[model samples]
Target: MAETATHSGTAVRVYDLHKSYREGAHALEVLHGVNLDIARGDLTLLMGPSGSGKTTLLTIMGLLMKPTSGRVELLGRDVTSLDESALPALRRRHVGFIFQNFNLLGALNAAENVEVVLGLQGVRGRAARKQAMALLDQVGLADRWSHLPDEMSGGEKQRVGVARALASQAELILADEPTGNLDSRTAAQVVDILRHLAHTENRAVLVVTHDLGLQEHADCVVRMRDGTIVEPHDGVAA
Candidate 1:
């Protein structure tokens, strides 16, 4: 990690994390004291087979789900202890999310969908629209900014989702199976965009995926099994 003068220097740090869910009469553990540190400008991929807790870990990191016990520091703040209202504000300011489903509003056009996030952050009307358009342009969807989700192709919709994630200017991005539904070519394009966001924009990106095709694009690969990170290795191939 790079040393900096600012307070929120480190992008992400987790220590002794644990999570459990209720299954029947038993408490099923999903994470077993996981520890991780992801620096800014890093693209880390968490991979494993089904039931491996990759998604569980990703959700916890994104602050969408609370851990049973642990320390989660994002940009230097101990977010693991934040209250519900503060957590939302913190997430809005620091984290962006991309999901496999695109999660676009069919009723809104691409630009409008991106604008929603800005609006929530107190930006409104023309200013929000302009910022949304700029992000769409960045994602190669300038011409399709006014198109609705149904009007665009699958890849185009996904691109719009990526643009929305970037529109917030968030420091950390969490993506869950972002390419799960696309063709190989489209998947490559999405991964390329994500990689550029991390390397060029100096953002910390963590992706949960089972796609081996994405291995080439990750800087670090973390393997999970049965609710625990088994090992983490550099992306250099064997």
Candidate 2:
């Protein structure tokens, strides 16, 4: 029930978004009426400085956080007023998140890590394990399916994290600094996989990164500084 933004073929649409954090007596405003549209088959990268609010916007789009005002539409549904209790289920059903640190469980093997996510989505037992292995294979990690986090290279662990993110077959994927910890070569490979999820699988992919290396892979690039989109961009050369 806020002001709207124009868009098409968008899996996620953000309109007039604003966010604030309470700091004692004052509310520190972060996002300043940002608007964006993420297409189902495109990889959108949001780049900005440390306090530019790009990550805040990404979290809001992923349903991991809510804004102070404005609207967020995911797959065409306005989720601005969803109850806190309902968020987990909604996120489980529609969203997948990839983090910079490759947050796999050190104690759990790669397949087991993915299985845990499937279990959250009501997939369990042998079925969950089978699906997890298949996803790992898709990420080209079939050989490392049973490796623990400590046993695998940084790239392999991230690939497992990617498999886990895809475990629930989510429609929207939000990655925060996903390549920050990897070397240049490995980072490109990971970006390629993210693009595959968007282009090949037709999922909506939004990545929040400061790395300019990602510019070439993005279908659209939204640059932010001081909490607003400040530049023009195009997607897919069309």
Winner by lDDT: 2
lDDT of each: 0.81, 0.83
Superposed Cα deviation of residue 54, candidate 2 (Å): 1.1
Q: For residue 224, give model 1's deviation from the true position in Å.
A: 0.9
Q: After superposition, how far is residue 124 of candidate 2 from its true place, in Å?
A: 2.1
* Candidate 1 local Cα displacement, residue 32, angstroms: 1.0
lDDT of 2 at 78: 92
Q: How does candidate 2 fare on TM-score? A: 0.92
> How many clashes show up per model?
0, 0
Off by over 4 Å in 1: 1-9, 233-238
- Model 1, range 1-238, lDDT digits (tens) per residue? 1212112245777788899999999999888888777767767778888988888887888888889999888887888888877888788888999989999999999999999988888889999989998889888999999899999998999999899889887999998988888987798788777777777788887888778887777766788887766775332211
lDDT of 2 by residue, 38-138 (tens): 87877778788899997888889888899999999888899999898888888888899998999899999999999999988788999998999899998
- Name the 10 consecutive residues with the lowest summed lDDT in model 2: 1-10
lDDT of 2 at 210: 77
